[model samples]
Target: MKKNSINRVIGFVIVGLVLLAAVIETGRSVYTWSQQAAKQPRYTIVIDPGHGGNDPGKIGINDVPEKDVNLAISLELKEILEQNDCRVVMTRQKDEALYQAGDTNKKVADLRARCQMINDSGADAVISIHQNSFTAESSRGAQVFYRASSQEGKKLADILQTQLVSGLDPDNRRVAKANSDYFMLKNTTATMVIVECGFLSNSKEAELLTQASYQRRVAWAVALGVLQYVSGGLS
Candidate 1:
């Protein structure tokens, strides 16, 4: 072969080898990225259906019991959370009451039992769901409450509010705050939030609460909020 032809042949072989090396590197990068994605933490979130059994909670003008509403919302919320790859645990999955109320303290004891379940579930946080009611029919909108002294609770609540407001309502009504009176908020070992999902006393809000479409929206917004917290941090 001519010397010039031999040199050209060598140059082509070198270029081919370089191209092959580039292809291998690109494939390896993609495979490594996918593996890292698969290894990311799959967080678990616990949902508490506030008020059950004899504890009817606040009754609406339409005679819709608070416990029923709490459970319904909670079940929907669980579905949303699970859809987003979060493992969910519910304190009450159905329309049963939580406390027997044998005595004034019996109700407290029952609440403690429920709280212990959330604490023991090994969940990152507990979202205790409930509906609000007041003498004023005009009262409406969702609210989020948290343990005032808990740094983790505050962090989750803050992220939740940012996510909740993004798609649900622009208003900051559902922000987290110190709520010492709630038994669940006070007792749970993990960071806790008690969400009052609108006022049943308000006629318009009460009607909206019972609708399936509205419930789905509420659940989705809640799940997004919770995810933002879980993915973020307690702070």
Candidate 2:
């Protein structure tokens, strides 16, 4: 019963994201009828909002936590995808660790567990959310990364970053290929792309990252980018 309740809560949150995406998609559709009656989309998109629970990734100018931002944007992304009819799964809902407490090897075991969840979900693709930080605030903009082992991973990264640049920012931040050393990217069985949405350390970008409106737009860009890739528009 406890596990079932947790699953329900998770589902509600995921469905909320899907609904937000649906509402946006419905508004943009050629007509409401097409959106209402369209057959279910043929893809399942697993959204892994990185660094939750005690792992609060990069701290921003206002001390905004990276885990919180990732969750917010990830929820928005799930909305955009579900509006377009994609099934979605999330790694964690509240700010809880994926692994049980008191585990000796927590970090690696936890990360691998997250990957196992994605692999078990039978998702077509996984998008791991993260925020970036560097000494250079000038290093602002979105970047998509893929595992070196997967060729299609490169294509997915290209499409997502291209769409983000063209639709959200015209600053061509470029796509990167990373080896399995990145934990999540290296271990997930599904076609995976990790997104460094923007640099949080930069004052200007940090301000934008904190806004709900901008987050939704970023989510939309990501959703469309993946769809474009899936539809063969970015090949």
Candidate 3:
């Protein structure tokens, strides 16, 4: 072959080898992901949508109630988890409170009832979804709170916080926090984390939280975090 032809042929061979390597790497990545997913323990999780019925929780800048936002995200997370072969138990599937009719101090009753459900379900983990509110309207991003005494809960929370910050809220600067004050987290027998999905007090975040696409993104990130925890990916 002529020198020019030989040079062209060598260049083509190098390009082909590079493409082949890329394809092999992609295949390896996919296989690894599938194997990890298959190795994940089948988990039963309790998804608590915080503050329903008379308890509207925080009111957002767009006038959307936090209860509704919480429920929306929880429902989406439930669907995603179920699709991944997880058994999901929802604390409340509707707008109604968990407390029975004519209950005195309905708020306390509602929380206690949720705790009972979490304990009775024998859940592997619990995710209580809520929207945050603050005196400052600039406060934004997702935050996760776990039981101070539960190491597994802290791990889960850390994974969730990482996923939320990296995938959904890239600007999020919050870290996973240990909170002993939340009734559900404090009382649940299972490893538990409370996800404050975003700040409803922030106009920008509140607008995003209300959108269905953003809700789905938040749910997907949470689901991935759960799967990662169960599969020992975080370890």
Clashes of each: 5, 6, 0
lDDT by residue (6-51, candidate 2, tens digit) is: 9999999999999999999877785766766566677888998888
lDDT, ranked from best to worst: 3, 2, 1
* Whole-model lDDT, model 1: 0.80
> Per-candidate TM vs. native?
0.76, 0.79, 0.81
lDDT of 2 at 18: 99
lDDT of candidate 1 over 59-103, digit per residue (tens): 887888888788888889998888777888887887665655475
Cα RMSD, each candidate: 8.5, 16.4, 14.2
lDDT of 2 at 53: 82
lDDT of 3 by residue, 1-235 (tens): 9999999999999999999999999999999999998976488889999999999999998999999999999999999999887889999999978888888999999999999999998888889999999999888989999999999999999999999999886778999999888878777779899999999999999999999999999999999999898778755
Top TM-score model: 3
Clash pairs for candidate 1: 52-97, 52-98, 53-96, 53-97, 53-98
Stretches of model 3 off by over 4 angstroms after superposition = 1-41
